[model samples]
Target: MAAYVIAYDVGTTGIKTCLIEVSGTIKLIASATEHYELHVLENGGVEQDPEDWWHAMSVTTKRVLERSGLPASSIQGISFCAQMQGLVLVDRHGVPVRRAMSYMDHRARLELKEGIANGIQIAGANVFKLLKSLAITGAVASSVKDPVWKYKWVERNEPAIFSKVYKWLDVKEYLICQCTGEFVMTQDSAFAALLYDTRKGKECFSESVCTMYGVDMTHLPRIVRSTDMVGRLTANAAAYLHLQEGTPVFGGGGDVSLIGVGAGAVEPGSTHIYSGTSGWVSTVVSRQLVDASAMIAAIVGANAGTYNYFAELETAGKCLEWVKDHLALDEINIYLEKKHVSEAYESPYESLYDYMMDAIKNVPAGSNGVIFTPWLHGNRSPFEDANARGMFFNIGLDTGKTEMIHAVLEGICYHLRWHLEAQEKKVNTSRVIRFVGGGALAPLTCQILSDILGREVETVENPHNVGAVGAAIVAAVGLGWLGKVDDAKQLIQASARYMPNMANKAVHDRNFKVFKALYKNNKKDFLLLNAGR
Candidate 1:
C-alpha cells in the first residue's frame, strides 16, 4: 500500500487537482479539473475572477479525494503549481481585492512602455536599467503582460484597489494562503517579481530597485522554499474539502517548474517542450542566462540552486480553437460526431477536437503551401513584437478548409521551432525533447511538431496531468517520501514518441524558409498597422 500527496495545478483557465502516490515511483491515483471564464475585452484586456479559481480548487479537491477512494489522512502533503505573471491582490484576511489581470492582458501596454523604454531601447528596457536588471535579475520584459506593468496599471488606473491591497500574490501563493492560512510565496514565484534582487545570495525585494521603480516592497509576500511545510490546512479549507484539520500544506514551485519535473527534465541539459494555450521550450541550465533581445531568461527552476532556460510564444493550442470557431466545418463536424458519437463525452471542446483531428487526418504536410502565422496574440519568444499578427499567407483559389487547418497546425509547430532554435543559443537543446501539455494528446500535432523541429518528441501518459504530477512529486519530496526532486522521474512513463516523416522533409524545409522570412518582411507593417488601433 502506498500513501499519497494531493496537489493542484491552478492554470490560466481552470484548476486541476490530483491524488498521486508518493512512493518511490510517483503515480496518479485520481485527477479532476474545473474550468472558469476568460473574459477578453476588445481593447486588449483579459481578466478572471479570483473567486472562480478558489471554487475550482475546492470543488476539484473534494472530487479527486472522493474518486481516489483514499482516506484524507493517507494524503501526507498538499502543494500547488499555478499560472505565473498574473497579479492577485488580496486583503489582510486573504480575500481578493479585484479580478486578476491575466498574463494575456494588454491594458498596461502604454504604462509598461512609458515606465520602461517605450520599445526604443534594448529589449524594451531602458539601456542603463537593462544592464542592471540583467545583472541582478537575469531577466527583464517591457511587455504589458509583465506583472510589474500590471501593478503600475492598477496603481495608475484603479487607485482605490491599490490603496486597499495588503499584498500582491501570484495564483499559487494565493491558493496556498487560502488552504494554509499563511501568506507566503515560493522561490520560483519570487523570481518572477521583477523587483527582486535575484542575483543576491538571498533573493529578496531590492530596496534600490523598489525605490527607483516606486514600488512598495511591503506589498510583496515573504518567500519560502517549495519544499517548506508552511502550515497545516486551516479549518475553513479542511471543512470545504472534507479533509482533516491538520493536513500538511507544502510549498511547491509554479506550473512551469513543476511541469519540468513532470516531464522528467530536472537534470541539467534536459529540454522539454510544452504547448497548451501558450507554448514554450525550456531547458534546465546550471547557471543564470539572459537574452534580452529574444525575451529569454534562465530563471529559477523547481529546485534550489538550479535554473531553466525559458522562452515562449503567445499562442499555440489557441490557434486550433480559432480555426474551430472561424471555419464552417459543419459537414465534417456532423459526420465525425456521428461517427464517434459512442465515444463522445459531454465536453464540447473534446468533441470538437475529435472532429477536427479526424477531418485533418489525411491532409498532406505544408498545408498545401498555405503558411499561417500563429501570432494571433503577438509573438513572445525568438523575438518580442506586440504589433505582430496572424496571417494565412499564400492562400490560393484552390485552398480548402482542411488545407488551411493543416496550415494552422503546421504554423504553430513552426513558431515553436523558431523558439527552440533561439533557446538553442543558450542551452544544449537535446535532439530528443520531452513534450508535455494538453495538446500532447493530439498525435497529429505531436507528429507535426517533431517533423518541424527534426527532434524526437515524446509524451508521457496523461500529458496534461503532468503539471499535477509535478506538484504532487514536489509535495512528496517535502514530506520525506522522496529524497530529491529528480528522483521523481520514476513516475514518468512515455506514452508516445513522434519521429519526423522524412518523405515530407523537403516540403517542411521549404515552408520553414518562408515561415522565417514572413515576420521580418512584415515587421514594419505590423507596427504601423497596430499603431492605428
Candidate 2:
C-alpha cells in the first residue's frame, strides 16, 4: 500500500540501486557492479567503452526491480548520482561513437594546454587542472585530461564522431537519456566539468571557443537542477526494466555533493570528512566563494538551493589498502581469524590496525624527525600539482616499520588539516565533523583526525553506502513524500563520536609544523624531478 522511490548511483566501479519507503527507510533492492579495464596506450592516454556503463545500468535496474517484487506503478520517482568529468559522445541516433573517457583517463593533457594557450581558461575550472597537471608532470598518465580538451580532441582527431554527435554528456546525463529519452544535465555535475560558469550558474560554451575548435554548442545537453524532474520513463525503457511508463526521473548531482546530503551536511558551516579511496574536508556554503590562488570555490550541487565548498587530499583509505597488499597480508589474515571468536573483532579488524598503531605509538610524535608526503598519485585540491609524488623524508637508520606507519597516519592527518583551515576561512557555521567511509571504522585514524582538528568527529554507521542512501533521499523529496532536504537527513544517525585528546593534540602540533615544512622544502625538488619528462 505504501509507495517507494528508487535511487541509482552510477559510480566509477559499477551501478548501485536502492528501494526506499517515503520515510527514508531502505527496502529490498539489487545492484550490478561491472569492472572495466582501463586502456593506457602511452604516457597520457586512458579510455573505456561507454556501452559498459549502459549495459551495467540496464542489468542493475532490472535486477533491483525484480528483487523488490513491487509493481512499476508503486515506484513514484527515480534519482541518480555519478562520477564527475567523464566525457561521452553520442551520435544523432543516440548511440555512442567511441569509448567514454572516464575521470581517471588522462590522455588529453597536451590538448588541455593547447586550449589554455588559445585563451581558454583550464585551471580553477573543475577536473581539468587536476587531470592535466598529473599528465604534464608525469605523476599520472592515465587521467582523461580536461573534458573541454577531450571535446576538442574528438573534434580534431575523430571528426566523423564529432560531426554526427548530437549530445555530449557526462555519465549521469547519458544514463538519464537512456532511461527516459531526455538529454539533460544537472547543474552540480556540470560545475565539476569546468565547462559551466559557477559564478553566474550558466553554461559557458563560448561561440568563439567552439568555432575555433569545430565544436557545436548544440551537442551539449540542457542544464537543470538536481531536484528537477527531467523526464518520465519511456515505454521501451519501462518494459526493459519492468517499470511503469511515465515514472518521474529527477536529475541528480555529482557523487561528492550527494554524499554531503547523505551525510547530513545540508546547512551552512556544516562540514564532513569522507575517507573512501581518497579523503576530503568539505563544508556547505551559501555563496560562491571563489579562491583564484588556492583552487577553492563553491561547486554547484543538485540544485541552486545549496553549494559545496571543499578540498581534497588525494589518498586516504587507498594508502591503507596499499599497505595491506604489500606489507601485512599475513598479519591481517591472522588477526581477522582471531577477531571472529572474541569481542576483539567487534572493531572489525581494529586489532590489526591497533597492532600497527601500537608499533608506531611509541615512535616519537614526528616519527623521529621523519615525514611522509601522501601524494602518491599527485596532489589534488589546495595544490593542483599532478607531478607531485609521495615521499618519506628525514628517515634515519633508527627508523623502523613502526615509525613509517606512524608517519603515514600523521601525514594524512596533516593534509586533511590543510584543507580544513582553508575551508574555515570562507564559511562560518557551527557543526561537528562527521567522519564517514572505511577510514571512519578505524578508531585510531578517527582519533588522530579529531586531535588534529581539535573538534569532535562523529562516525556514522554504514558510512560506505551513504551516497546511495542520499540518492534515495532525493527521490523521496522529489515525490513530495519528504518536506525538505533537512527532513530527509534525519534518517541518518551517528554511531559514535570521537573527541580530541588534548595531549595528543599537543604532540601532533609539533609534528604538523614539520609536516608543513616538508612540502615547502621539497616542492621544488618534486617539480624538478618531472622536468623534461
**Per-model TM values vs. the true structure:** 0.94, 0.81
Consecutive 10-residue window with the lowest summed lDDT within model 1? 337-346
lDDT of each: 0.82, 0.68
Instruction: Name the TM-score of candidate 1.
Output: 0.94
Task: Compose the digit string of candidate 1's lDDT tens values, residues 404-482.
Answer: 8889989988888887888877678888889999778898889988888877889988888788888887777788777
User: Residue 84 in candidate 2 has what lDDT?
Assistant: 73
Those runs of model 1 whose alpha carbons end farther than 4 Å from true positions after fitting are: 118-120, 335-350
| lDDT score at residue 211, model 2, on the 0-100 scale | 47
List candidate 2 segments past 4 Å from native: 24-41, 62-73, 117-145, 157-160, 197-215, 239-245, 330-370, 394-406, 429-431, 528-533
TM-score, candidate number 2: 0.81
What are the per-residue Cα lDDT tens digits for candidate 2 across 1-533? Answer: 45677777776556677666655444435444455455544444457677777677667767776777777788888888777778888876667888887665545556655554334344443344434432222111122244767777777788787777888888888878888888887877666655554434334433433444345678877888777788999998787767789999888777777888877777777788888767888788776665534555577665346677767776776676566555554443434443354455325535555555644556655667677778766666677765677788878888766677777877888888888877767676345898886678777788888888888998876676667667777766676776677764576777789888888788778877777777677778877885323
How many clashing pairs per prediction, in order?
0, 7
